[model samples]
Target: MLYKFFVKYLKPYKKIVFIAPIFMLTEVIVDLFQPFLIQQIIDKGLGAGNINYVIRIGFFMCILSLIGILAGLSTIYLSSKISQNFGGYLREDTFKKIMSLSFKNLDHQSPSNLIIRLTNDVTQVQNLILMSFRILVRAPLLLVGSFFMAFFTAKSLSPIIVILVIVITVVLYIIVHKSTPFFTNSQKALDRLNTVLNENFTGIRAVKAFVREDYEINKFDKKNENLYSSSTKASLATALIMPFLMLCVNFGIVASLYFGGQFVIGGTLAVGQIVAFINYLLQILVSLLISGMLLMNVSRAIVSVKRIIEIHDMQPDITYKTETVDNIKGDVTFDHVYFKYSDNDEYILKDINFDAKAGETVGIIGLTGSGKSTLADLIPRLYDTTKGKVLIDNKDVKEYSEKSLRSQISIVLQKAILFAGKLNTNIRYGNQSASDIEVEEAAETAQAKEFIDKFPEKYEKFISQKGSNLSGGQRQRVSIARGLVGEPKILILDDSTSALDAKSEALVKEALANEHKDTTTFIIAQKISSIKTADKILVIDAGKLISIGTHEELLKSSELYKEIYESQLGKEA
Candidate 1:
């Protein structure tokens, strides 16, 4: 999976990945020459009692050191370039993919996990690229080069080299296999920790209101402990690699000295030969240790690659067309609509049929979880109906392009979400090209201008994250203003006035009726007063639309409607 992902994403930087290794090989070659040069200095210069020869060879070694330094620097530069570009491109693609996914697809994916993949996971892959250009490329080259050079130079020492290599190889394979699964578990632990944090911050207000600080702390500590344990276990598993390899390296050193000393005493090897043999042995063992570290990194990188692959393979559930429908007038119709979250789930909306003409106020009133919001959601195609059609402008909603359909319909969701920006910027979000006058008009229409004008900065006042700086009603009004700024043909207010006082709600309703008379509207509300004056009111019970008529007519005909009215209006009805 890592190989495939790298090939697909790093195609642009493959040349750099390839070239960096060439420089690494150059460094390795230069390193391999060092032991031989030392051997030459000891045998020819020192043994012959020639100071000039010592000076000449020592200077030549310095020149080789310079070349090696240059090669190492070049490899570092190229590696950094490849890794950063590779990571940058992958992050960009992941963000774009997240944006393109349908709401249904997003429901299954955790935001915390997605964030980890974009940041920590991609960073791990970037590290793999860096290691590839550095130790990954150089280690094997130095290991092989030193071993063969030692073999050809001292055939008698071959058994020592072969045995040490075999022992280290077996040890590395076992350690890496044991540690690979731990890396995957640790990544999951990180996701869980981030999830706890996200929930805490987003609902910090609720936590404070209920005084559940200790409960939240306990939750965080539990997740944090799991993350700690998982990370420590992974670290322990890989930590074994370094010591085991070092022990094997020491064993090789002992074998080299014992065997080579005997050979020198027997006159079969010179002192320089034994010394050079030891040098080569050290190089081989050191390279093996570096190779072990690289394998540990590969294990972690493989886990991240698998995670990223999961996201890359996801296809959006709702497909949209690029072809726009002409004159989208927002004439919405639900024709025998049936909807369920999935095939196995019960229908949230069942056998529903209704129509709202191009310029009328349609009110949907129901109890909690009675499908008022879900039914309203169909008008903008947030979720497609499972067994029927939702039509816009008399055309199936799916027939219009996403931009053409959604851009014409504005929905201020039940939550009244506001972003961290100036008031003007928030309002202009619906239509970026809306002029200052248009923005002010929209705010006035939503009754948001009253409070906004009180801010010292007025429209330029900086709103905090999620509008935490504002009151609930203020946030709701800001959201309504944002929706109205685009002058959408269809506007759906899903319990948007629930936060406002009765007077404030009345003012907003009066402004909407006067300013947006030609806009088709849907009001999904729990309070009867909110929708009492709507042109047509639809009464819903369970998942079915039970009655549809004017307010006075429904009070007379529907027991359910009359029950709701009597319960709320309290005999004043």
Candidate 2:
């Protein structure tokens, strides 16, 4: 998975990837030659008192250092360029895939988790890519070069290098393996903590209204503590790597000195060889330290790659039938339909059957959670039925592509949603090309014009995020105006007017009746009065079609309908 992600993203920057390593190779070669030059100075120039030779070799070393610095800088620049561009593409594709996913697939994913995957997880992969071109490439090449050079310099003390490599490799393996699980848990804990933050901020009004500050604080602290604990555990595991590597260094140096002194006294080793061999050993230690740290990071990056791959692999895009429909005239039907949410065992809508012709106003009355909104969703193909079919204009809903179907059907959910922008822009969201007069007409129909006219800027007034600056009724009116602006063939208002007073609700309904006479309308309401005057009223109970008739007929023919009416109207009924 990691290899595939690298190749896929880096393919566009293959030239950069190739060139980066060349510079890194140049840097590593310069680093290896430095120890050899020092040995030459110590043994040939300094030992023989040839000041000119020492000065010449020292100048050559400085030139090599400059070349190494230039090469390192070049490598850094190329690596950063490739990694950042690669990260951009990775994040873009991941976001596109998420946007294309079916609502069913989205229902299973948390907003917080998706946010982390797009930001933090992509960053992890990019960091690994950046280091791969620099530390990763340099470490192995320098390690091998230093090992060969050191072995030749003083073959008798080669045991230190071999033993040090073996021990550090084993220690690094244990450390990285132990830390991987902790790092995964840390990422999950971060998701939970972020989720708490999102909920708290989004529902801060409710929390403050209910005086739940202490409750929210305690909840946040618990999740925050989980994140801290998991991160600490992972950090501790990787932290041991440096100290263990330094210990190996101390051992290798002590052994090198003891063996070199004996070999020197016996006339087998020179003082210059001892100094050069120690320098090479230090280089190997540095390489190993870099390798160990990179390995741990690679483990974490692998987790992120797997997450991105999972999203790519999901059979998530909503499918369309081979047959196509050019237009929707809002003739909707549910034929023996059964509906259930993804991963749910019980159905929310069962064996449902209904019909609504174009230009008819259908009021759906039901107990809360009795599938009123779910039924409306089927008309727009927000979800596919589990059994039987949802047909529109005498064809299966799947016959129309997602865009074609949803464009013709506008649903104003029970909860009003608004973006941060000018009030006109919020209404124009339903139809970006809508004219100014059309936008004003929509606002008037939704009973939003009266309050909007009071603002100095009127339609151009800035709306806060989620319309937090607007009251509940004002927000609902604005959302209704947005949905109505497009003048869709089918309109589903799922208790969208619940926030408005009875008079405002009646005015909005009357305006809809007059202005959108040709549009099929579905009104899902809690109050019996809200739907009592509908041309057709469908009583739903426990996900079944309990009764279907107009208000007067239902009162006489349906006991459940009469009971609901009496409960609401009391003496008036």
Q: How many residue pairs clash in each candidate?
A: 0, 0
lDDT of 1 by residue, 136-196 (tens): 8899999999998898767898899999899989988988899888899899999999999
Q: List residue ranges in candidate 2 displaced over 4 A.
A: 321-325, 570-573
Could you give candidate 2's per-residue lDDT for residues 51-92 as a string of tens digits?
Answer: 999999999999999999999999999999998998999999
What do the candidate models score in CA lDDT, each in turn?
0.89, 0.91
Model 1 regions more than 4 Å off: 323-325, 570-573
Candidates in order, TM-scores: namely 0.97, 0.97
